[model samples]
Target: MKVTRLLGSGVELADGSRIAAGTVIWTGGMRASALTEQGSGQRDPLGRLHVALDLSVTGAAHVYAAGDVTLAATDDHGNHAMMACQHAIDMGRYAGHNVAADLLGLPTMPYQQPFYVTCLDLGGAGAVYTEGWHREVKLTGADPARSVVA
Candidate 1:
C-alpha cells in the first residue's frame, strides 16, 4: 500500500476525526485521525497486561520503559512500536533476545532502533524507499541507501 507523509497535526478527510501520535486512524481506507498530541492522558487499561522486562522476573528487578505510552501507563509495561515494519522486525529480534536471556539467566541486550523505511509506489511502475515519513525525506539522510540499511 502507498502511504503519504502527513505534515502538521496530520492529514484528515471531510469528517472531523483526527489521528495523532503518528498513528494512522482511517475510515474506509481514508485517514480520519492522526496523533496531534501523543500520549495525551490516553491510557489503555488492557495494555497493563503485557509482561514487563525487568532485571529479574523472579520478583526482583529494575524494569523500565522508553517509548511513547510511558506517560499513559496505568501501571507498568507499556510501549509503542516504531510505527514501521523495519522497526517491527528489529523489535521482534530484540524481544526474542530478551526472552531467551531472561529465561536462561543470560545477559540482556540493549534496544537500538535505526530508523524507518517506506516503499512508495509512484504511478504504475516506480517505487522509492524513504528513511522517514516526512517532507524532508529527500535530504541527504533520506537516501535510498539508508533505507536499504534498515
Candidate 2:
C-alpha cells in the first residue's frame, strides 16, 4: 500500500482511504540518493550502484559503494543484499575494510552473508521470526518475544 500523505496520527492511502491509529510506522521502502547519479556506473532498479565483491563500483575504478547505495552479492548461492539496515551494516563494514586493504596493498575479503533472519513485530499480537531468503517461519508468539526481547 502506498501512502499519499501522513496524517497527524496515521496515514492517507493512495486509494483515498484514511487509517486512524495511535502510532504509524511507515516502512514504505527507499530509493538511492541522487548523489549516485553524479557517478558513472551500472545501477539497479532502485538506483543503487552495482558493486563488486569487495564493494567497489563495477567499471568505476577506485570508486566504492556500500550501505543502501549499493547492489551487492551476499553469498555464493546467488543471494543479493537488500536495502535494509541489516545488510547495510555488514556492507559498510566490508566496504571500510576493503577500501583500507586496497589502499595498503592488502588482500580484500569478499562480502558474504549466507545466513539470513528476520523478525517482524505484530504489535499486540506479538511477533514472528523467520530464517533464510524464503522466510521460513522459525518462531512466533512467545518464542519471538523471548528471543527478541533481550
Candidate 3:
C-alpha cells in the first residue's frame, strides 16, 4: 500500500483517490516516561526530556538522563536520539563520565553519536544488520557475512 497525502480523518493517494481511515496505528519508535513533565525540564515531540550537551536536563541541570528518556541532539542537523540500544550504551557512558567530571571539577564529555546501526530480528525471514542512520541493510538473512564481529 502506498500513501500520498494525509487528510483530517483520512488520507489521499497519488492516484487522486481519498480513503477514509478508521484507525491509524503509527509505527514510530518507543515512548518515554512522563516524569519530565513533573519537573521544569522540556520535552520533545516524543515526550523525551530535552538534554544539554552534557546529557543533563535543560532546565534542571542537576539531573542527567540517557537512553530513550532524553532527547539529546545526535547530530548538527537536529537529529535527536532514537530509542535504540545503539544510542543508550553510548549515552550512558557519556552521562556517567560527565557526572563524574562535574564532581571532579573537570570538563564534561559532550554526548555525540554520529554513527547509527540496527540489528533487526526478522523472525522466519531471518535477520538483518544495518549501518548508518539511513539504516541500509549491509548484511541480511542467513548469509555468512551477516555474522556480527566484535
Question: CA lDDT, every prediction?
Answer: 0.41, 0.87, 0.80
Candidate 2 ranges beyond 4 A from true positions:
1-5, 12-27
Q: In candidate 3, what are the lDDT values of residues 1-150, reduced to their tens digit?
A: 566777788877788788899655556467888776798777877889988888988878567899988888887876778888878889999999988888888998789988877776655577888887788878888662346543
**In order, how many clashes per candidate?**
9, 0, 0
Model 3: ten consecutive residues of lowest lDDT: 141-150
Candidates sorted on lDDT, descending: 2, 3, 1
Scored by lDDT, model 1 comes in at 0.41
* Ranked by TM-score, top first: 2, 3, 1
**Model 2, span 36-145: residue lDDT tens:** 89887989889999888899999987777888899899988889988888899999899899889888989888888888888998867888999999999999996696
Q: Write the per-residue lDDT of candidate 1 for residues 98-118, one digit (tens) a residue.
A: 667767878777555434456
Where in model 3 is the C-alpha error above 4 Å? 1-29, 144-146
TM-score, model 2 to reference: 0.84
